[model samples]
Target chain A: MAETAHAASREHFGSTSRRDSWWLAPGLVAAGLLLLGGYATWAALQGTHFEFGRYLSPLYSPKIAAPWWPLSPALLILIPPLLFRSTCYYYRKAYYRAFFLDPVACAVGELNRGKYTGETGFPFVLQNLHRFAFYLAFLWLFFLWHDVWDAFWFDGRFGVGLGTLVILASTGTLTLYTFSCHSFRHLVGGKLDCFSCTAAARGRHGAWLGVSALNEHHMGFAWISLVSVCFADFYVRLLSMGVFHDVRLL
Target chain B: MPEAVLHVYRGDASGGGLKEYRVPLEEGMVVLDAIHHIQGHQAPDLAVRWNCKAAKCGSCSAEVNGKPKLLCKTRMDALPPGQPVVVQPLKAFPIVKDLVTDVQWNYEVNKRIPPFTPKPNAEWRWKQEDVDRVQEFRKCIECFLCQDVCHVLRSHGRTDAFAGPRFLVRVAGLEMHPMDALNRTKFLKEDAGIGLCNITKCCTEVCPEDITITDNAIIPLKERVVDDHYDPVRMLVRLVTGKKKGE
Candidate 1:
C-alpha cells in the first residue's frame, strides 16, 4: 500500500489555511446581540422612557397593565419578541454559532467535549418554546401595527412625521422577519402534501410560496429588523428624553 | 479537448495539501472522469474512491469547489472554466484516505434503529397518501451529502449526540411508515438528539435526491418529540392513562 497522507489527521479546533478573517461575522453578531441585549435590559429596567408623544417603543408595546408587578413592564412586553427571537430558527443558528461557538462556521473545527448532549437538557431544551412563541409573536404584530396606526395620528389628527416614518419602516421590516419564520412557513403550507387540491389549500400554497420567498432572505431580515427595532427605540428614547426634538413633516 | 486544473488533496492522516493536476476535459466530462485521468496519466499512486460512474452508489461523494457533490454527477462545464476545481474529502467524518472518509459511524447508527415492526396479525394494507409521504424519505440514496452539509455534524462534530440529517430522514421513513408499529419517538428525542436541529434546511438544499429534509422529516419529527415529551396535557394523560399518546 502506498503511504498516503490523510487530511483527517490534520483536524484541529479550527481551519488550518490562512483565510481572510473568518471570526469577523460571528464577532459582529456577538457584539450586535450584546449591545441590543444590554440596551434592552437597561431600557426595560428604566421603564419610563418607553412612551413618547405618539410613538411607543417596541420594547414596551402592548403596555403591560400591571404597573405594581415586581418586574419591569418591559419584561412582559418583551416576552413575545424575546421568545420569538430566542426560538427563531435563523436566530438559533446565529446565536448558537456566534455565542456558543458551536462549530463557528462551515469546515471549521469545534470544541470537542465528548458526546454532544444537544438540546435534550435543561436550558437548551427550552428552545422548543419557539413554536409557542410563534403564536405570541403573531399576536404581537397586531399591537405593533396598532402602534404604527397611533404613530400616524399625533394628538388625534392624521399626520406623518419622521417618527411615523421611522416606526413604519421598523414595523415593516419586523413584519417581514416575523412572517418569514420557519414555524410560520410550516404553518402556512409546509405541512400540506398537495398544493393543487382544493381552493383553500391552493391559496395557502400560494401564501406559503410567498412566505418561502421571504424566508429565503430570513437572515437578512433578522439582522435588519433587529437594527430597525433598536433604532426605533433609540429615536423614541431621544424624543422622550428630550435629547432630540421630533421633526414634524406635516 | 479543453484542459482543466484540478486541485486535489493529496496527503493523509498525518498532514497533506492540495496538489494541482492538469487534465484534458472531454466534451461532456464529469469530475470523476478528470480524477481518473489524473490517476492514469500523472499520478498512478493517486487514491480516489468511486463505484458507479452513475450517481447511484453514493461512493463518489466529495467536496467539489467548496460544495458537497457526487463527482460522477458534477459536470465540468457547470463549474467555472478559469479556476482550479478543488476536490476534497467530506468534512464531517474521519478521512481514511484521499476522498473517502470513514462513514461507518452512519452504518452503526443505522444498526441502533429498530427495524419496522408490524402489529400482530394486522392488515398490511396502507393508504397511498401515507405511502406517498414516506416514499419521499425512501428516495434517499444514502449519499451522506445531507450528513456532510448538516452544521451540527459538519461544523460541531457532535456525532456522539446528534445523529445527522441522513439518519433523521431514515428515522422519518420508519416513523412515518403506515404499517410500522413501534414508536421511535423516545429514541429520536433522547438518543438521536432531534432537538439539536434548528431546521435551517441546509440539508434539503444539498440533497441530490431532492428530499425536503427539514420540512418533511426533521420538523414533523420535532413536532412529534414536542407532543410526546413537552405537551402538558399529553404528559398528564400519559401519567394517568399509562398509554402512549400517539399509539
Candidate 2:
C-alpha cells in the first residue's frame, strides 16, 4: 500500500491549486462575450432587421418580406442585465458561489435530506426522478438544434450556412458542460461496478478531461449555464426576426 | 450570557452514567469550551481528548447533543435553547474514557485500501487545476461526522459491509484526482462497500465545509464504477481496439 501510494503520487501530476497562470480562461471568455454582444447590438440598430414575429417566422412558410414593425421592446431592455449577470460567471469564479450556493440565494429545490422517510419507497422514489430530469436535460441537446432551425435563413448571409454549425458547436459545448455535472452522471447510473465497462465510452472518454476543465471553471459553469440558455434563446429570437445578426467570422 | 447545564456522559466501556454540571456560557462559546470549563473548574478528572481548538485537527470530536460534530466549531447559541446540552463519546468507536473514543479503527480502515498508484512513468509537474480538484477534499479535518452519521455503521450496524462515508470521501478524493492515477474503485466497491450509501445525503448535511458529498463525490464515483464494469459496449471496444481505460 505504501509502495502504491508513492506510485500514485508519481503518475498524474494532479495539481489543482487556483494559481497556475489561471487568468487566461476567464479573460478570453470575457473578451469574446463582449465582442459578440457589442457587435450584435450595434448591428441591430443599423441593420433593417427588428422584425417582431421572428420566432414565429419559419413556421410562417414560404417566407414573405419581414414586417418592419417593432414589438414592445420592454422585454428586450431586461436582456442586457440578465445576460451580463449570467455570463459574468463565465469570467469570474467568486460570482458563481455568491449566486448559486448562497443559502438565501440558492434555487428552492435542493431536496433537503431532512425530508427523508428511511422507508424503501420514498427516498429511492425521489432518486429515480433524477433520470427523468436527465431526459429533460438530454432534450437540451436537441433544443439547440431547434434554436438552429429557428435561426436558419435561406435569404440571409448567402442562405444560412454556418448557423447550424455554430449552434452545433454551442450545443456540443453545452452537452460537455452538462454531462460533466455530478448529478447527471449519477442519473446515467454507471457506478455499479468496476471502471472497465463496455457501454460507458461516452462517460469514460469525457470524465477526465471534461471533469478537470469544468472543475476549473465550475463557478463559471454554475453561472453561465443559466445565462447561456437565455442568450441562445434570445440569439435565436433576435436573428430569426432579423432584429440582430450574430454577424461574426469565427 | 446564561450559564449552561452541561450533562456530560461520564463513563467508559464499563458503562457509567451522566454527570451534570453548570458552566458559564459566553456569546461565542463552543461545546468544547464548555467541556473545558467543566474540566478545569469542576471536574479535573473529566477525560476528553482535544488538541487544536480549530476544527482542523479533528481530535475534539464528541457527540454534541447526540449529533457528531467537531467541538471547537459548534456554537452554543446553535443548541436548542431550553434543554441542557447533552454530550457523549463517539458511539461507533469504543469509549476510551469520558468524551474521547478510540478512532484507531478509522485509520485501520484507511490502511486496507491500496495507496495511490499513478500511471506508468507519469512524472510531470503538477498542474494547478489538478491540485485544486483535491484541495477541498484535503479540507477534511477527519472529524468523522460523516462516519458517525453514516447509518450503515451507526444505525444499521453494517460494520462488515460498509466502509462508511468519511473513508469513501477520502478514497473518492484520491481516486478522482487527476494527479493520482491509481484505480482504487475495485477496492472501494469490494472492500469499502461503496454501494451501501443510498444517496440519503445525510453525510452532506452534517459536513461543516458544506462539501457536496452525495452529489459530487459519491454519486459520480458510483457512475464511473457502473460504466467501467457494467457497460458492455465499452468492454467490446476495449477488446477490439486493444486499448485500456484508466485503471
Highest lDDT scorer: 1
Residue B11, model 1: lDDT of: 70
Q: Please give the lDDT score at residue A193 for candidate 2.
A: 25
What tens digits encode model 2's per-residue C-alpha lDDT throughout B1-247? Answer: 5888888988777777688999888988999999999889999999998898988788888777656778898898988777788887766666768987777667777878777767578665554534554566777778877776665455444556566777777887777665566676577666776755565455786787777676567766665654455446567888898877533
Candidate 2: regions farther than 4 A off: A1-250, B245-247
lDDT of 1 by residue, A100-161 (tens): 77656554566766655557677888876667888898899899999999999978899998
Query: Model 2: per-residue lDDT, tens digit, A2-93?
Result: 11111001111112111123335435545555655454454433333332322321111122343553633323432433333332212222
Q: By summed lDDT, which 10 consecutive residues of candidate 1 chain B come out lowest?
A: B124-133
Residue A29 of model 1 has an lDDT of 86
How many pairs collide in each candidate, listed in order?
5, 35
Q: What is the C-alpha lDDT of each candidate?
A: 0.79, 0.55
Q: Which residue pairs of candidate 1 clash?
A: A5-B11, A5-B12, A6-B11, A6-B12, A6-B13
Per-residue lDDT tens digits for candidate 1, residues B23-113, read 9979899999999999999998888789988888888898887678899999999987788889998877778777778787888778878
User: Share of real contacts kept by model 1?
Assistant: 0.16
DockQ of each: 0.18, 0.05
